[model samples]
Target: MVYIAGEEMTHYATELFVDQWIKPYFDISTWETYDLSCKSRDVTDDKVLHDAVEAGARIGAIFKEPTITPSTVQVKEMGLSKAFGSPNGAMRKGWNGITISRDTIHIKGIELGYKNQVLFERHAVGGEYGAGYNEVGAGTLLTTYLPDDNSPPFVVDKRDLTDDNNVVVVYHNPYDNVKELAHIFFGRCLEHKVTPYIVTKKTVFKWQEGFWSTMKEIFEKDYKDTFLKEGLLERSGNELTHLISDAATMQLIRWTDGGFGMAAHNYDGDMLTDQIAQVHRSPGFITSNLVGKSDDGSLIKEFEASHGTVSDLWNDHLAGKETSLNPLGLVEAMIGAMQHAAMLDVEKHPDDASKLEVKMKVLNFTETLREAMHNTFRYGQGTRDMSGPSGFSTEDFIGKVAWRLNR
Candidate 1:
């Protein structure tokens, strides 16, 4: 397992969680660690970020803390070399990430929202997130496609600008990785017995047709038969379905009992998941996992809390005040990383009795930790975010979880 440490209140909370909750039953001292805090990234000129991604792919699983992507003002505040971009884009590109999965977390006795499981898969690369743009003044703009395969370069688009100041943006979607994303998304849905939904704005953005078409093609070839046989999409008459982005949003709100999995392109996914997170109480009540493949075709999974560092809580902590910072998302992420590592070990040494024992032990630990965290909420003893004015502080919340685990 690879542990990528970050900055702020979440980091402090994470360390406390691991020390109190994890170290008791499991030994994490052997785990590889990388400090990805702003200072560390600046000191290494962001090389540490790439190195951490490489380590995650090699190690098979990574648990990451939320880190800062310094802005121009933040660069001056932190005295950094330059305003570095988000490490997420680089990590996703580096790991050949296909999809990011965010599922709603539920406690046994508590029902905040979403009566059923809602699994969302977002295509983790390309779209507006990777677009390149430049300001232009009344001039002919030519967009060209230069093939590296010795083919002649051709003009993709040519526009005559009429406005004084305009912007030209260039971006592309790759058809190659869409198949991998579909397989992952559909496979998980099938595994969990949920209806799979493909969402896109293909009608408006014709360019997005490629994504929907590829997903449909792959579903027909690989998953449609099983989906029909299992009657998973019985509500849609045992047929796969595609929802326009707008309709998908409407359905997400209307269908509060979420027994479905939806996959969308990068931008749509980003927005939709935010909605899903809110519907499920908060981002902390969501589980985030990025599924990818390395160059060797081996799968690499990275887990992290969907929320950012709790800057407000950290400030309070610095002022020597108690804070009720919730670490549910971070704890769940750690459980995912540990479980993935254990599964990888079993896969590598399937016949080894010792390996099987280790896998079982890890699995038991994860299951127990999950129950303990949820039980904390079930007993009305979580952090203030979830448990209101009478809630425990951050330390007290974790300490309560630890006590539950031990008892």
Candidate 2:
């Protein structure tokens, strides 16, 4: 397995996150790592992203700390060759990944933490994020694709503009990629044993209608029977109904019994997942994992915290001030990668008792890791951001987890 440490406070926090898990469970130095830090990404021209993605597919799993996606200002300040694209975006394309699984944190006996549910956002191949565009003064733009020597250019969109109007054209293909995303969505819902809802804005964007349509067909044609056999859909609609993206947003906020699973297009997923994070608690409460299965039978998986690189926390750290940054999302991602690695091993050697034993160990460790994080809350202790009875610094918080696991 590989773990990538991104820039900023995450740059530092990820080190501790990794330390907390590996020292107790396995040889700390045995884990493979690549620095996807901003400076590193610039220096290496994002070669690390490719290396990490390739490693994830080959090794079956990767865990990552958040990286700062650079803007023009950041590019100049860092003195980079060029503004690097999102490391997350590059990894997604490299692996043909589906949506990152978003789940809320739940703290027991406390009415606060959000319920656990999966947000299955469509991600792969194309979207607004990866599109390249340049500012234009005045010109007519045409989109074209030519198949071969005998073919003519097939134009998609053409527009003419005056000097007063500035425009950009970027294209994204949600065609073939949507199928993989849909399969993953339905499969994950079944795995989690929850009603699954696919949300889309069919009215606004007819193309996105394809997402809802294709997903519906796949679920009914392939997964419905199995879902019924498992007795998974409790609602009258079997929880497989389509909701307008708008309505789905409301339900996410309204549902009390933990709105089990939801699938959305990439943009909707990005927006709604963050909203869930904020309402549920901090963004730290959310956990994410990106995955895809190749035709070659390899599962390419990348696990990461849902939140961004904590720039503010990085500032505090740089100032040599003790900060209480929440690394919950990052730590949870590591746990996911570990458990997935164990599961894959068990699948390979089903009859091997040693493999089963290791799987159990990883699982037990996952439980302890989670409990340790919550244990702080149970004991009226936490980071300053958590506003607990007494706050602990980042090191102290990790120490608490280590202490609990050992004790």
Candidate 3:
């Protein structure tokens, strides 16, 4: 676990996730943590984040919690170097994590804002998050890709600016990462038996075509035969489908019955997933994973809660008040990491029948843990956010879940 605790609740929330959920299922020796909280990030000059990524790469999987992304005020208050970039992005790139998958959370019988499981697989490496931009006096703005001496400089874009009236931000996506993003997307859809919707606005930015084009080419070439053979899309009756990102948003808002997945570009995925998180109830109800391919083309995955550090709840905790914090997202992520690790462990010892028993045990525990949580919420034993003032405190709520697990 790479926990970047922030404010108050995130720290406690992650701790509760470990104690109430994971500790009951797996040995404490199975995991460790790297603190990338604001202070830790600053103290290590952000080396800690990189180290965590390296550790994840070595271990094959990691579970992370939301950390504070310092702004100018935070930079000064925390007395940091420059206001650091998002730790998520840093780890994403370092881990070669290309696809971010988030699933909606629904509790049985409880009115979650939306009930659908909306899966978003995004192009993770290059996008607005890692763009180069500057405030300056402008004339003609141009983007030039100067290759090695063997290749000519490719002028991708150029624009004439009348005055200092324009500021430009730009980035380019790598085709390799885009391709892997498709592979993970389609493969997971197949695993879950859900329809895959490739979402993009190639209608506007021609560059956006790369997203849909890669997904289509790969789906047709590699997955089409198996997908059709399995009758995966029999209900929808489409081999491959594309939706403009804008219209897809509408479909998602109306996506109530809950069985579809979508592939989107980075910025679009970043924003749309947040909307889905809310529609599905709260960010606390979302399970996020960063899935990527290694140099050997093997898959690499890291799981995290879809939400940020719960600064508001942390504030209440700071005030020394009894606080109720939803640990569901964090719990989901830890289970995901365990599942991933278990799969790898099984792969390493495929002939060892004992490992399969371990897999079954871990998965059974994971499902039981989830059922207990939802059952708790169904009977209104959740935190304040879900059940209002009548809800239980953080520790107490998880204790109810733990008790259910014990039974």
* Candidates' C-alpha lDDT: 0.89, 0.76, 0.79
Q: Which stretches of candidate 3 lie over 4 Å from their true place?
A: 1-7, 224-239, 351-357
For candidate 2, lDDT tens digit of each residue in 1-407? 67777778876877776666567568646467888877887778778777887777777778888887789998899888888877776677777776677877667865554455545564554666666687887878888877789677788788887776575858575577677777777777777777788788888877777777888889889999898888777673564688888997888778756747777767778888887887776888788888776557767777888888888877888899888887778888888888888888888788999999988988997888788888886676777656553688888887887778777
lDDT of 1 by residue, 72-140 (tens): 888999999888889999888888888899888888778867988899999998989999999989989
lDDT of 3 at 328: 87
Using Cα atoms with residue i matched to residue i, what is each candidate's TM-score against the true structure? 0.96, 0.89, 0.91
What 10-residue stretch in candidate 1 is worst by lDDT? Answer: 233-242
Clashes of each: 0, 0, 1
C-alpha lDDT of residue 114 in model 3: 65
Question: Highest TM-score: which candidate?
Answer: 1
Candidate 3 residue-wise lDDT, 46-106, digit = tens: 8887788787777776877777888899899878888888877777777788888888777
